[model samples]
Every structure is written in C-alpha cells, then in structure tokens.
Target: MAVYQALKTAGVDAVTIDTANGFRSKLKRDPVDLVFLALHGIGGEDGTIQKILNRFKIPYVGSGPQASSLAFDKVKAKQIFHRNGIPTPRYAVITTKNWKRILKNWQTPYVIKPVQEGSSIGIFFVEKKQNPAKKVEAALKKYDRLLVEEKIDGREFTVGILGSEALPVIELRPKRKFYDYQAKYTKGMTEYLVPAPIPEKLTKSLQIMALKAHRALGLRDLSRVDFRTDARNHPFVLEVNSIPGFTETSLLPKAAAEIGLDFSGLCLKLLSMAQNGSKEK
Candidate 1:
C-alpha cells in the first residue's frame, strides 16, 4: 500500500488491484494509466501477469515478459550470465532421475534450492559434515527440480539498479548460517550497511557488474543484483531480482535514499519511466 499511497499523494488517481481475485475484471471496469506491480513469488513475478499485460496492451512498471521469465528461473538466469561472461557460482541441475549421479559427482558445502523461488525459500546449505543425499532426495520429492550451487565463502552484498545507474552497494550481515527467509524479513536478524565501506574501486566494479547483469537480462527501469565475493574479493553474480520489493524499507528504496531520492520520488520515477517508455538515463 506504500506505492498506492505515494501515487495518491502525488495527485494521481491510484487504485490497488489484488491480483489474486478478479483483478482483470477490475481493470476492465476501472482502467488505470499504469500498473505498479507489487506482487511477489510465482504467479506474480514469474512473467504470468506481464504476459497478460502485454496481450492487453497495458504498460507496467517493470521488465517485459521475456526478462521476467528469465529472471524468475535460476537455472536460465545462470545460463544467461555465463553467455554474457558474467561470473556465477558453479551449479548443476538435480532431478529424480539424476539425483544419485549428482550426489556422487557434486561436493558438499553447496546450496540446494528450487529453480523458481524467491525470498530464499526452500534454500538449504549442506556443510562438510552433513550428508547431502537425504536433503537432495527430500527436496526432489517436493520440487520437481533443484539447483545445487557451490557455496561462496565470503561476504554477501546487493547492488540496487535504478534506471541506468547502480545504487550504492549494501553489505548484508546475517545472524544466521545464511540469509534465509527469516533473516531477510525479521527486523533484527540481519544488518545492512548501505554504501558499504569498501574501496572506491571495488564498489564501482560491483555497480558496473550489476548493470551488465541487468542489461543482459533485458530488464528495464529497476532491478536488484545480488552478489557474493570470495575470500580473494572476486565478485560472483548470484542472481538478479527483476522486480524487487518497493516498500519504504525495501533494499531498492533504501539504496535510492542514499542518492537523495525519497520513497515517493522513487515511486514517481519508476512511473514516469513506464509512462514515457524511457530507457536507462
């Protein structure tokens, strides 16, 4: 509702449509100028709604259908990164048919997650002492396919992309084993250091790498690229969030604030970008 109120305060007749129920009928009844998608997870962020909007010739405030789909699927996104010469962790696909082979070939100290999930849902880290076979079997029962990714031993950081510019890098310090779903949403579980105190050179490099990942995915207006730097400080592109959260306290808005862009201003900027079909500035 933050985005909704922001638009209302900006003197625009904004209406909120819950995509769960009869949003289509509502759109037909009260056609709005643009759609500020605040939806998350499967049906919302996985290009389903974007494809619908494209069919109806409605302009939305995020990437197109192709980019949304690519960003939603971890396996496909990693492939795109590899094609563009973007550095990502080594990974392999695990299925019911190939689970045994993966277990024998792949090592521990890796992450197992569903291909198309968000907010770190269903993510598990198998350490050196733990047995990955059980986790792999159980996960395959729930999810059709999973990704086994080599874990990067280093600090975690995220770079928010606004238009063509990369916002300040924010280092994430989680109080848990890794930044899981709870650590991400719980108020005090994680600490975020904006404009993370790093050398100017490394910061700029992260920002540039984030922009390249965004462009490679054909994303527009806004995005958030996650990163993991090794012990040697070599940054690897984890994944890109094509449509990240937009609340006042969300990471993207927080980064934008560093550059003197307030919450309302950020909302309006994205809206303006969609309305004018503006490319990266």
Candidate 2:
C-alpha cells in the first residue's frame, strides 16, 4: 500500500497484483511496461517470480533472477563475498546430518539462521557455552540448510544502493536482542539513525564493500547491503537485500529521504533507472 501510494504520488501509473491465481495470466491480460515487485519472502524474493518475469521478457525493478537467488540464500552470498575477499563474518553452513559436527567446531556466541528465509525469520542466537548442535539439527529438519555466523558485537548499519550509487548509511538500534522480523515491521520497536555517525574513511570503505557485494551478485536497479562493525571497528558485510521493503518506514526510503529524495522522488528515480536499462551511475 505504501509503495503504490509513493509511486502514484511520483506520477507513475502503477497497478497492484496478487499472485493468488498466477502472475502470468495477469501479465498476459494487462501487459506492464515494468514491474516494481514488493512481495517479500519465499516465492517472491527467492528469484522464482523474477525468473518467470524474465521468461516473459519483462524488465522489472531490482536484481535479476541469479542475483536474487544468490542474495536470498545467505550461505551462497557469504561464499561469494568470501571468494571475492569481501569482509564478512566467518561462518559455516550446516545440514541436518552434519549439524552437530559443524557446531562442535564453531566458536560461539553465534547466530543460526535459515539460509533462504528473509525478514530475519527463524533466526536464533546461541551463547558460547550452550550446545546449539542438537537444537540446530532439529531446526534443520524443517529446512535444507542453516547459516551459523560469528556474532559481531557492535552497531548494525544498512546501506541503500541505487544503481551504482551508495546512499547514506542507516544505523538500526532494535530494542530486541536482534533486528528480528517483529522489530523490523512493528512500529516503535526499533530506532533508525540515518547517516550513521562513523569516520569518513570507514564509511567510504563500507560503501565500497557494499558496491562490490552488489556487483558480485549481479544486482540491478537497487538493493540494501547490511553490515556490522566489530569491536575493532571493522565493518563486515552481513547480507544483501535484493528486494528491500518499500514501506513508509523502510530503511531504503528513509536513507533516500535523508539525502533530499522524497518518497515519490525515490520511487520515480528507481522507475527511471529501470526504464533506462542498466546505465547505473
């Protein structure tokens, strides 16, 4: 509702569709110039819908199918980041069979999360002395794999990228243990600090790392790169949000607003970028 309202305010003729029946039929009936996808989780952000749109030769806002898929899966994105020498937390991927074996070797306080799920769903924090193996193994019975990452204690920041330009960083301070699903969407559960107060050099470094992560995944139009600065003040890339939320209070829009880009203006810019076809600047 917020995204549509923003786009409408921006003078873009946007229409809403529900994937109840199928998007193909809707696309065939009412062909669109481009799609600004707002769907979250599973079938939406996991690249399934993007692949379908690509099959129909439709140009949509945000990353391509491969990039979307890679970003959606936390473990795979971390692998790409590691391979490219991008700074990210040391972690291990766990399957049900090897969950115990892997956990036994990992140092804790660590984060155990669903590899492909988003909105911070199904995330658990395990302390140093606790045995996460059994619990993690039980959790993995419901999912294919899980990502266990070293918990970096510091501040959480998210960088919004419009094409190749990195927007100002937004620092998230959640009242909860971590920025879980509830804190992200529920009002007043978190405090967002736009243009995070960090050293200029560190901010620039973070921006560079974010752009590298974006390009590594072949992301297009826009994305939000999350990070955590450790005690040593070294920033580590957490994950990339290829299809970030477009709600009024969403971090991307907030960061854009801080830079004098209003909601409508931001929407228009994204739409224009999509129309222009990949000349990111």
- Clashes by residue pair, model 2: none
| Candidate 1, 1-281: lDDT as tens digits | 99999889989888888887888888888887788889888888889998888776788898888888999999999999999999999999989999788767777788898999999988999888788778778888889999989999999999999989999999999999899988999999999999898889989999999999999999888999999999999999999998898888889999999999999999999998888782321
Error of 2 at 238 (Å): 0.9
Native-to-model Cα distance after best TM-score fit, residue 73 in candidate 2, in Å: 1.4
What local lDDT score does residue 46 receive in model 2, on the 0 to 100 scale? 78
Model 1: weakest 10-residue lDDT segment is 272-281
* Structure candidate 1, residue pairs in collision: none
Q: State which candidate has the highest lDDT.
A: 1
Per-residue lDDT tens digits of candidate 2, residues 184-213? Answer: 989999999878888889889888999999
TM-score for each predicted model, relative to the true structure: 0.97, 0.95
lDDT of each: 0.90, 0.86
Clashes of each: 0, 0
**Which candidate wins on TM-score?**
1
Alpha-carbon RMSD to native, per candidate: 1.7, 1.9
